[model samples]
Target: MAKQWLNKVLELGEVKGGLAWGRFLFDGNRWVTLMEQAPKGKLVGTDYHGNRYFENEGDIYTRKRFVIYAEKRTNAYNPTSVPPEWHAWLNYINDYEPTTFDYKPPVYALKAEVTATGTPKGAWADPDKRNWLKYSAWAPPSSGARGGKA
Candidate 1:
């Protein structure tokens, strides 16, 4: 019992040091979540996006699954950031590992919020809002304005 508490304390310290000050100090909800999940979970695999997946089966009924976000430690992490295959495993939709299936992610999966202001690049491209086709080239008045012969 003492060892578990010590381990939890150590893990909390590590998490506090590794992440940003805002995440450690302000995001108490995620801190509690990490505290709950860090002790017993076993790391299963890392996805292409750097997200970590963990599972714990302690002879209890249902196995527990957790994920560590690969993005910044801020609260900006979204469910869309998780890939489909990993999402299935995290939600217990499939017992088999995602690697067992030959699945391909769509083009949108590659899109990310490139700007610091939380605006997505490829996903936020709306033709109706900002249409590039509406722009036309500037043409000179005519030959008569320049005193050119007809």
Candidate 2:
């Protein structure tokens, strides 16, 4: 079991660099948890986005379910990134596996997913309420250029 899990980890951490892919990407706690908790869980299924779901029968309480998101390589996942069906299973909302069921999202839901992913939340869209500096090239003026002492 340990060897199989190690092989999976090696496969997961392998990248085009020919070295461990996620070593530099994930933080310390995340890396450790991935190495430890993973050994106890059985791979339940994988979602369309590549998120891997695991179930640990040994863990009767707390979270028996967990997910290794598709974006683990870049460590860029968030709760918002998971699809609704997968989210439901992860949170124990349902015991059913996501892809096994016949399900289709509403048209509006799909649109929202596409729009939200490439941009910020609509509530934070107003420029006056927040700065877009992080997502934009708009830099503040130099002190001298802005009429401050050089």
Candidate 3:
């Protein structure tokens, strides 16, 4: 949180990948956590985007599955970074692992907000709303509100 505030004030922009996370070039804490969890879990598979999935059946009641995102922490926090097939398995929608070869989202699935934003597909998002430092009168359009219809 402090880093985000500092970035905005200094116009330094967002943190550069994971290097800024710890004293080392890599995320030390994550590495440490993984080292500890290594024995309790086994890697499932890596998705097309390089996100690694793991399943821990060490205990039947506490069995769990999770993904270690390949994207930087900042990018990973964005929900859109996780694709649908992976999400399905993570959420128990499907017990089987998805084949990661050339994984393309289904036509019905929405595109990532980062890709959709500032594009026709995500016109609903208002950049002004994200600009907390600036005052904006922008209001999201209601159903049939912006157009002449209603």
Which predicted model would earn the best TM-score? 2
How high is each candidate's TM-score?
0.55, 0.58, 0.45
RMSD of each: 8.3, 9.0, 13.9
lDDT of 3: 0.55
Q: Which lDDT tens digits does candidate 2 get at residues 3-122?
A: 888776655434335344444344554465467666777888886666788888887655688877665434455566577887888888878877687657777775214123544533
Q: lDDT for each of the candidates?
A: 0.64, 0.64, 0.55
Cα error, candidate 1, residue 22 (Å): 4.8
- In order, how many clashes per candidate? 0, 0, 0
Could you tell me the TM-score of candidate 2?
A: 0.58
Query: What would the TM-score be for candidate 3 when compared with the true structure?
Result: 0.45
Ranking by lDDT: 1, 2, 3
Alpha carbon lDDT at 108, candidate 1: 70
Q: Clashing pairs in model 2?
A: none
Which tens-of-lDDT digit does each residue in 62-114 have in candidate 3?
Answer: 34776666654432234455677778877788776776544577779875433
Scanning candidate 2 in windows of ten residues, the lowest lDDT window is 111-120
**Tens-digit lDDT string for candidate 1 (28-98):** 65666466665676778878777777776762445488777666545655666677788888887887677
